[model samples]
Target: MRDRIVRRVILPVAVAAALSAVAGCSLSGGTGSHKGPAAPSGSAAGRADPQAAAALRGVEQATVRAGSARIESATAMGGMLSLRTDGALGWSGDPVGTLRITYTGGQLAATMRALSSTSLEARLLPDAYYAKVGDTFARRLQGRHWIRYGYGDLAALPGGSGAYLTDQLRDTAPLQPVRLLRACGDVRRVGEETVRGRRTTHYAGTITPAALGGADAAGLRERLEQAGVTRESVDIWVDDRGLLVKKVERGELISGRMSATAYYRDYGVKVSAGRPPAADTADFRELLSTRGS
Candidate 1:
């Protein structure tokens, strides 16, 4: 009974929790080879307004240069999970940060409590994520309290979508709105607005399969397709310094409607993450192996 519950129910919920953290961290598009934002050359540029294009590129460059920021986000993944996360993330050319994630409500929330509690402390590194589970889960793991999930392992999970999820985590950052703007055929500035008491310029655009067709478009297209979205709407608020202050993504998925809203502040903040003690941590894969034995 314990093994069956752990394997069938707990593992999936745990994976979802880790994925929720990743997904909630950044609402941006996939990571590409380019170090900074540059206008897509050739015919693609012809379709976009030169002024709008320049504004987006400026936002991307300024964001990347800012390094890190405090982030607060709320994400709903169809009916699978809904979560709110608050923490700081650093993307100074690498994905590294920390977040305090809470499972407000969802089907996965019930199972999450079985392993630990609804709240989890997540440490994000360049290659993996470490989550701190509770004493209840620790008792079953020979006293280990942390579960380590490597990005490569996430890609090899039971479903093919695991790879897509892994890619999202790897490519996502606070500056993701700028990445989405790169694929927009018609990006327009919706004038200036106030976001959290700060004046910011609003930009809105739609992403379609047709707009994404270039050397750097493959990864972005794959991410959109995996989300079951033919078209996704993106809106962003950027401060005068060209930093992303807020972003929202809305789209239709096979399961249902999906959306996320994120607010960023305190740019250029110093942040750091340390690995859990190996001796006191367990790999998620090994935990599942105990099933049915």
Candidate 2:
């Protein structure tokens, strides 16, 4: 009976945590406000402040040039999940890194106590994300300490947004927020501010997926709409070196309010990740189908 209860509570929590992580790492969100134009429905052709646009473009190019950075981030998804992730991310090609994710609060945190775990290590690769389980659940998992979630398989998830998440996971870099804000076409320099003791120029704007360009623009819009992401306010802090030092994204998700704050530093930092041993890893999709494998 206890095993049954454990299975029921733990699986859902895992799913919730995974999905929230998807949204959190997914490209493009920001916080704070500005006097930008109202978010457009389906066009990035809205009147744009050319000067601000150029400035952000410079930031985007600078960030892209740096290639990698150490990131510390906190994310909240309604009342379902709250986590802090610390790691380094490299984005020259596909993003790859390892992060220690600690459950800070919310439902998932409470349920994680069932396994005596409130934290996990996530390794992000080009095609999948791997979760490392601690010893508490390793015994039950047949000494399997890793669970693999393929981005391709996640696309098959119920909501269409899962596909969007898949795409973002494969292609997004830390500089993605800058590109998204540039797509907003009305981004503005919000003045100067100090972030973590470093002087930075603040920039903020509001955007909708439909108002964005690039491949799959329409599909991205539709998926985000399904997720209840209509408009997101984005704030980025750039240091004198023209790199993103801090960013905050705030918006409403289907579940409720969703927000994230991330700080970046040590640009050009070497980032590394390696796949967990195949023999000791479980595919989460397979586990879901085979009654937790």
Candidate 3:
């Protein structure tokens, strides 16, 4: 009876966690908001510059609290994450482990793992962290923990870094069309929304890049699809400053079971910006420089 329970329940739970890691990583960053004018029919007729379009979709810096996030995967399972600026991060439906991130500046990092059904072990260190599942070293890097854990964990970190990366890529000016050609599968203006009482424009799209900055493009794409990248929806809330105040996402894996939502605040972040993930350009360079044998 004990073995059976562990196999049917515990093992599946762990697998879900592993899968969550993948989905969560991609969905991390800002919340989705605002609906913009329709993209022109052809690439030639549309706003030729994506950066300016992105800037037009940005928000200003401010601090917000009482944030919540949830994710569902089509194949394995689903999970949710919540946080209050003054309180600890909370999670539900966690399988492998629970992860909590700490943010000091615009940059963020952490270490997380599954402890049990209702509990997790997390160390949100800003500079460097060590992660392991059982005895296996999961990751040890100067990169963002979200990049390491996949998408689920990425949904919990502070700042809107994930959204930042996506927007940066999606809105690359002059070559916005080119950027979209190679970096994304499709783009659209979802609509508008109210984020923290502020009206903003919203946008959604898919990332089908040949290679992620730090992952196996093919394998990662499969993982993302399993985690709900099929109709991968990204909502960006853009204000005057062009800063992403909120980013919302709904990811579906194999069976489309896991979905997540995250909101960011305390913008104009100057502290953590120069730290790890953001500051460590050299680290990313090294990772990319590695020969893929």
Candidate 4:
């Protein structure tokens, strides 16, 4: 149970939380008062789909301008894990936030219970993230209640792809959808749709390997390849004011199929996250080293 939770639930959720922080960065369009032209419906003429590009560019600019948001998300990885998270995050330039994550169902949830609970409080900072674990797990760390995972340390983990995790946490979360759009071969407006009761413009696209290449690729292609995602589908919903309200990403990983859906709100809301008390926090790398010895 411990192994399963660590592999399937804990690690995946940590990644998801980091990515979700990025989502906050792209969804808040500065003070929530800025507005852009509405997206055109259906596919626009041209190889580059100028209409779609313009609309998404507006979303990108708005999100960067706003800088913070409240988010709710759900993620699933095949049948191994299913989880939900709710939190507020800031992405003005550096990512900062906190989340209450719950293991809702699946094998991972069962395993989490062995540690005394199926929920965790995660705090994200510019350089690392901290997870509050149950007392059962804390007992293994000389009674420490938190585990700190630094972005740099994640790169040195066992998996050769661990660096990808570090890169994503450090750089790619908020603009992942925008990157997908830039790398997509068939970006188009899917028409207007209702999301969480608000009217929004729906955009969809397919990300192919060929699309992943460019002078400014930013290593996204290599990261996707490492995860076994040859091709993936992406969907985004932008609210009437030109802010991203929701997004969905789906793809196959070497481990299994994975999907995540996230909703964003309260753009420009103030958010802050602080490091756990040093005395009560254990560095994840040290924990691993100690266990190995």
Candidate 5:
């Protein structure tokens, strides 16, 4: 009985399939991607308005100074899979957080329900994502409920999705959109708007990583290209205090349309995510190796 259970988890097909569903692809349409101005090409790339450039620079600074915050985010792809995450994340240094990630609607959600769960407790450390299995499979996992996917191992995976996932896990944070805005440099200030009852200045831009040039240009282009993202539309809301209150980034992928919306609050919050016990955890790479053998 133990051997059978071990075999089932060695490959962890269900978990791997769920990863593929979102793996760097928010690829979606309805969430306002088409409504915005498309990215300019050729000579029009980085000529952002002076005021807009300055504002984004301030935004980048403000958000980075805030250090950490509570985040609620939802992402969907091609109308097929949607998921949400709620947690506090610390980005003062290496990103870290503990999030309850729920697969809300999708064929994958159905499979999770069949397994008696649609949510997973994920600990996001600087180097890896540790997903805690549900009770239904904990016994079968032999009291080992955690599965570790190291970012380096993920980057080594053959597909572009893995590299994309690596980029997302490693470089992603509330500060990402702001950085992208500064990098894209063709930002437009869309005046003021109310967000979650707070007044905010709306800003929008299109990002084509390859068109950008600077210290950040090469890394952005390489990471994005490896993820199969040709271009993206991003928008952000910054409050009077210059903190990012919300952001929307949408783009297309070979599989479908992708969209993600995130809200930030409770800035300066103290965040902690201690590692799982090694005895109660399994490294996904090790599991793959064992299965292959």
Candidate 6:
């Protein structure tokens, strides 16, 4: 059973299909490539508007010096897991690039620029991202490889074909904090509480975008069906300073908990737009290519 589960997860059926559509290649075949959209319009409008309920989202995005948060969750399977992300705000470790996320109007745009570091190791893997460490004197580098497999597609909204992944992005928007106000949803403060010894403000809400309707909606439904999973509500916990501390959510293929802790560790006050120096894909390409080769 363990082996079967591993295999199933290794080649998430939904991901495989999505890749095939975009790359025209299967995970078993390394002949796939991803082409971005021809330049999206209406983004300006999207960024200008803020959802009515998430006014406090701005406070959460303020410059966080240093902090940490914990996440304790009960899965649909009755399993419990706890996780943490240290240095969430904007703490520049020993040396290297800087990861920043800022809100424009009401939209959240992030930029991972080259920091005072060298020997940086940034890669866009099959489903996630990783950056290497370096020194200050090194020239800053940046670029966009592709949509993070683990994160939602920023180019599109959470609906219509592949809504599963898009929805996942919006669900965890609080983790970035910038989207608290930009994301279209109803959020209510669930009062204050202490999580993992740190005092945090808890918020509960549901996101149902009317944009997720019409014939186009069928595409999203189909993608979910391919994954053998359904969409679920997302719950979040934020610190007293309004920063996101934790998020609990379930998606079609994967469900887990993500948390941030440590002073401005992985978190950033604001972000810039434009591509980075170069894209990273060595790790994921290696993982997929080795097997295929």
Put the candidates in TM-score order, highest first: 4, 1, 5, 2, 3, 6
Which of candidates 3 and 6 is the stronger one according to lDDT? 3
After superposition, the stretches of candidate 5 with alpha carbons farther than 4 Å from their true spots are 1-47, 159-163
Please write out the lDDT profile of model 6 over residues 165-254, one tens digit for every residue: 333322222232223223423455556677667787655443232323333345434433433323223345566555655554423223
Q: Write the per-residue lDDT of candidate 1 for residues 1-293, one digit (tens) a residue.
A: 76557644454444444443333322222212223222222223334555876788888788778888888887765555677878887878667778887776566666667667678888878878777877887877788888887888778877566776676666546554566666666677777889999999887766665577445577667666665555566778899999888887765554455567888899999989998899989886786567554
Among all candidates shown, the one with the greatest lDDT: 1
Off by over 4 Å in 3: 1-24, 27-121, 126-182, 206-229, 269-293
| Poorest lDDT segment (10 consecutive residues) of candidate 1 | 25-34
Q: List clashing residue pairs in candidate 5.
A: 26-258, 27-257, 27-258, 28-257, 28-258
Structural similarity to truth (TM-score) of each candidate: 0.82, 0.79, 0.38, 0.82, 0.79, 0.36
Runs in model 4 lying further than 4 Å from the true structure: 1-48, 213-218
lDDT of 4 by residue, 1-293 (tens): 44333633364444444354335211100111113222322455224565886788788788788788888888765566667878887878777888888877666577777777578888879889888888887786789888888877778866664565666555523467766675565677888889889999988776655576444455666656665554456778999777788888765454555567888889899899888999999887775555321
Per-residue CA lDDT of model 3 for 153-220, tens digit only, reads 33333454433332222211111221232234344454567778877656445443333222234545
Whole-model lDDT for model 2 versus the true structure?
0.67
Q: Give the clashing pairs for model 2.
A: 30-233, 30-234, 30-248, 30-249, 30-250, 31-248, 31-249
Query: Candidates 5 and 6: which is better by TM-score?
Result: 5
In terms of lDDT, which candidate is stronger, 3 or 5?
Answer: 5
Clashes of each: 0, 7, 68, 2, 5, 39
Give the higher-TM-score candidate: 3 or 4: 4
Give the CA lDDT, 0 to 100, for residue 58 in model 6.
Answer: 51
Q: Per-residue lDDT for 211 in model 6? A: 28
Clashing pairs in 4: 22-174, 30-66
